[model samples]
Target chain A: MRVLLVDDERELISALAERLEMRGIQTRWVTSGRQAIEAMAQDCFDLAVLDVRMPGMGGLELKHRLAQSCPRMKFIFLTAYGSEQAFDSVATDMGDDFYLVKPVDIQELMAKINLLAGKEDA
Target chain B: MNPAPRSLTMDALQFSGTVTAAFSHDFKNTLAIIKENTGLLVDLLAMAEKGRPLDPQRLATLAERIGRQVQRADRMTAELNRFAHSADLPEAQTDLGAMLEMAVVLSARPANLKRVGLEAVTAPPLWIATFPFGLQQLLYRCIALLLDRAGSGGRIVLEADDGRPPVALRVIARTAEDRIPAGETAPTPTPEMTGLAHALQIRLDWDAAAGGWRLTWRDVET
Candidate 1:
């Protein structure tokens, strides 16, 4: 499945992208929401893995903006905060199924991504 | 009528929350990088077990990157710890330069978000007896305001002057055009700014000619 990853942490996103690619998932990554928007303008993806708190445009806000153009694209939010309150606040606005907290388990993340893309058995 | 002291308490709490949240986010990013690098190593080892040729050079690079991130996390935690303890003593003798340096570090996340570069100029040792936490809060607010006004791709230079009768700290916005446009007066201080200045017992004024804000306070070390 094709995926787009957006995060401000360069090292984290690069390593995660490499791992996802190694697992045979086509993935592209950008370091900021602005960059992700620019990339989306040039290409399309089936799903987006986004970090909730970014510098310029945070993940939630970015997702709202991206939805305007690519209504079919799915989203999975990644956050560093694992607190219930934090999750509940965002989950209430966005869905709870697609959220993962860091340091995320790669296997779990892969499974979630596959499930979100409707390729659960894969 | 003067606002209740509770309002000042709430302001301090808000300031603390803001700084802690910024530091926590930074720490999490650092940890995430380390986790990914280590995971990559594990993946590589698993591949090697399957007869895939493992590049020792790549492994070494990953190890080095992990080590670097660890050190970065250490520094961030240290700064956070120091900031947390800033309130330990309500009032104490404080090193002005050191306090400003810490303020710059704590203010970095917001400054970066605004695409503003922050630089603290070297200043000689200047000791002042004051409310350490209050001073930090005041400095943070001033820096935040300056960052907002700095616009995108701007730079701010922070300087501490020790020789002056009333020691002064200056926040200058580096821009092509002067921070204060011609014939226009300096912007009035917001209520938050006024309250913080009163609490800290410092004079915060706009230095229109210098294109910045100057915070002046008499050294309490008689």
Candidate 2:
């Protein structure tokens, strides 16, 4: 399955992308919302993993922007500031299954991605 | 007591809470990077154990990257430590340049988000006796205001002017469009900020000619 990862934390995103790729999943990553937009323009992906609090366009905003063109793309948010209130607010708008707290378990993340894309048995 | 002082105290508490949240967010990001790198190393090791060829050079590079991230985390922690202790003392002698440097470091994440550059102008060391935490908050607010005005791809320079007794600390926007006219309504300081400045005898004003904001205070005689 192909995945696009977006985050301002370069090291975290790069490491996550490499780990995902190692697990036999196609992964592409960018450090900003703008880069993610550009990448989406050039290529398509089954899912997009995004950090909720990016500088310019945060994950929620980016997700909204991308929904216009890539309606089929699934989204999962990763955030370091994962308070219950914040999670509930996001869940109210995008549902609970689409969020993951930072320092995420790669296995869990993969399972979620697969589950979201209906590739859990893959 | 008066309600004004009570209100100011509440404002200070709110400011402290805000700064703490920001610092916590930064620390979490740092820890997240380290965690990911370590996790990747584990994955590589598992692969190696499963009879996959391991590139020694790649492992070395990954190790080096993790080391650098640890150092980065260390620096961030040191800054946070310093900031946490700032409130311990009500008033103290502080190096203006050093304080500004700390402010710049703390402001880095927000500035990056806005795509704004922050630079400290080279100047002789100047010391001031004041409420260090309050001063920090004042500087942070000013810098944040400037960054908002700067928009993306703009730069702001921190400068110091040596005066007779009171020295001037300036935040200058590098672009003309970012300049705030003297007559223009400047960003309003928080009530707590105003109280802190008033107590510390610091003057904050817009300098149209300099195209920036100036914070002036009397230097403490050591």
Candidate 3:
């Protein structure tokens, strides 16, 4: 499946992308929301994994824009904040079951991706 | 009649508290990143246990990055510790260069977040008998404001000089709001700025023509 990664933290984003690529997934990575929007204009991806607290354009705002542009593209938010309060607020707005915090087990993430991506395959 | 010292003392306390809270929040976030990195390593190990091959090179790099972050986190903690204890404190001999280095590191994260490069012009460690904590607080708040206003790919320069008879540190500004041309008296210190300067026994000058502000400690008796 194709994945798009967005994060201002270069190290984390690069590492995550490398890991995901190793798992046999096609991935494209961008550091900012603007870049992510531009990438979407150029090509479509199955999922967009975003960091929540990027500087200029935050993740939730980016999600809103992406939802409008690419309705079919799924989203998974990766944040350092583990508070339930933060999660609940984002979950209501995102309307998806794929919000995961940082340090998420790769296997669990893969399982969730398989489950979501399988909607088309099934 | 001398202005009541209590009011100045209270203001200093409040300023220190805000600074400490901000610094601690930053430190906490750094720790959180390190925690996440370690957790990722653990996941990689678990994957190896499950008969999946993991890249040794990536693991090594990740380990190195975590170590660097730990040292970064340690330095931030030390700054926070010193700042927290320096409430309405008297003047003491301080290494101006080291203090600026700490502030630069603390400010760099925000600058990097805003895509700004925070740079400091280093001089030899000039001995200044000043309340270093107050100076740090003043500098931190100003840099934070500048970084917030500075757009992506902007640059902020922090320089120290021995020219003011008493040591002086000037923060070179970037944004239109921060620009202060040189050789001019600094604008009146805001009440907040004045209060902080009062606590540190330093004088703050706003130089509009030079496009920056200067803090000097000339009056404090050694």
RMSD per prediction, one decimal? 3.0, 3.4, 5.7
lDDT of 1 by residue, B56-164 (tens): 9999999999999999999998998999888998778888889889888989998877778788887887878778888888888777766656667776778887645
Evaluate model 2: give its lDDT: 0.79
Best by DockQ: 2
Per-residue lDDT tens digits of candidate 3, residues B1-222?
A: 645445655655765665554565455456545665676687689889999999999799889988987887788777766655554456677778777876786566566657777778888767767676667767876676556444575667788885446677877666434443334443444566777776676777765654566777756432
Grade the docking of candidate 1. medium
Cand. 1 TM to true fold: 0.89
Ranking by DockQ: 2, 1, 3
Clashing pairs in 1: none
Q: Report how far off residue B190 is in candidate 3 (Å).
A: 5.1
Clashes of each: 0, 0, 14
* Worst 10 contiguous positions by lDDT, candidate 2 chain B: B175-184
- Comparing 1 and 3 on DockQ, the stronger one: 1
**Leading candidate by lDDT:** 1
lDDT of 2 at A43: 96
Residue B146 in candidate 2 has what lDDT?
77
lDDT of 2 by residue, B91-173 (tens): 88787888878778767778877788888876677877777888887787788777866667777788778634667789877
